[model samples]
Target: MTIAAYTLAAVLNVFILFIGVRFLLQPFAAAAGYGVPATQDRAYLEIKGVRDTTFGVVGLVLLIFAGAQAEAWYMLAVALAPIGDTFIVLRHGGSKAVAFGVHLATAAVVLISSALLFLA
Candidate 1:
């Protein structure tokens, strides 16, 4: 249980880190893949980077500093972010595949992490 919880947490942390970096380095690519493109605007790009990076680091901190129980709550709440991301992508001219594949999958992973943390 401990291994599962920690593994899930680590994977989420890394996944979020990748997202943040992608958003920063490939803003247009990331936005387009996210289902909404910012029209010649840098602000949204930076915002995306900030948002993803914050989520990643916060989740990491929760796991490392607060322990499994707090991380469980964090995962449960943070699941909503990806659920919303799913809708955002689906509603904003994003493909069904990306919406379900990426965002929904992420939500599921978060939920599973919550369950594992609970068990731990």
Candidate 2:
């Protein structure tokens, strides 16, 4: 059993749960962090909230239900998603801070998770 892998999986799962809660409870703030302002349309806000929450929950489930190695692979695959998100935010007039702070940060964390998984 690799210590780093287990540690990474556990930490990542907890963080994902936190992210899911943030999306659900503070949708606007979460959206702002995601480099997007809340839209006037409720549907769009709901979409973001639901999507983020789902991702978080699914990530957590991968760790809990699957295993550290599996979660690691999941993290690796999902890294591309945030990379894409960074560009999307930038292309859509999002500020640098939001793009880097949220999306880039997420990608880094995911990469770290992947490394840990690999070490495991």
- Candidate 2 lDDT over 1-120, as tens digits, reads 577677766776566567657766777777777787775565565665666567667777877788777778888887887899899899989998878988888899889878877777
**Pairs clashing within candidate 1:** none
Lowest lDDT block of 10, candidate 1? 33-42
Give the lDDT of residue 97 in candidate 2. Answer: 88
* Candidate 1 global TM-score: 0.92
The residue-by-residue lDDT of candidate 1 on 1-120, one tens digit each, is: 799899989899878878888999988887887767766787788787888899889989988899999999989998998999899888888888989998999899899999999899
In angstroms, give how far residue 64 of model 2 lies from its true place: 2.5
